[model samples]
Target: MNKSEMIDAIAARTDLSKVASAKALDAVIETIVESVAQGEAVTLVGFGSFKASERAAREGKNPKTGAKILIPQTIVPKFAAGATFKARVAGKDE
Candidate 1:
């Protein structure tokens, strides 16, 4: 769901006003983004972990031109779901 829809759901579930729920969601998103940008991992039990992974430079094929291209190495954000989160998504547990 989109941010506004998520805010509404959170507000109703927590008995919080929409404004407060929005603020809380914003803070959570901002905190996660900032932490990941700093090359740090953030983990919430029963949820998941966010971290950065390295991509080594490699050769790639340019599909459009059928040519060789050099793919620059970089750090990319990655997420790994916790056991509980994975189970919930797989319909094994909640």
Candidate 2:
């Protein structure tokens, strides 16, 4: 669901109002982004972990021209779902 829909869900599931829920969600997202950008990992049990990963430089072809190009190395964000989350998504968890 989108942000407003998610905010509605959070508000329904908690005592917080929509404004508070939105702020909380925004805070959480900002914190995760900041942590990963700083080369730190953030883990939420039964959910997932977010971290920064290195990508090596590689050669790639331009799709339109079919010309070879060097893709520069970079740091990218990564996420690995927790086992419980995986199980739930796979319908193996109650």
Candidate 3:
């Protein structure tokens, strides 16, 4: 679901107003982003963990031109779902 729909769900589940739910969601998102950007990990027990990961430089082919190119190394955000979340998504209960 989109942000608006997610906000509605949060409001419904927490008895919060839509505005309040939106702010809460925004705060959570901002916190996660800031933490990952600073090379930290944020973990939600039953959800997932977010962290920054390094990718090594590699050679790649350009699809359009079929030319070889060097892909630079970079740090990127990564997420690994928690056990509970994985179980739930797989239609099983933890």
TM-scores across all candidates?
0.93, 0.97, 0.95
lDDT for position 7 in model 3: 99
Clashes of each: 0, 0, 0
User: Cα lDDT of model 2 overall?
Assistant: 0.98
Residue 83 miss distance in model 2 (angstroms): 0.6
Instruction: Give me the displacement of residue 49 in model 1, in angstroms.
Output: 0.2
lDDT (C-alpha, whole model) for all candidates: 0.95, 0.98, 0.97
In model 2, which runs have C-alpha deviations exceeding 4 angstroms?
none
**Top of the candidates by lDDT:** 2
Please list the residue runs of candidate 3 whose C-alpha ends up more than 4 Å from where it truly belongs after superposition: none
Against the true structure, whose TM-score is highest? 2
By lDDT, rank the candidates, best first. 2, 3, 1
Q: Write the per-residue lDDT of candidate 3 for residues 1-94, one digit (tens) a residue.
A: 9999999999999989999999999999999999999999999999999999999999999999999999999999999999999999999994
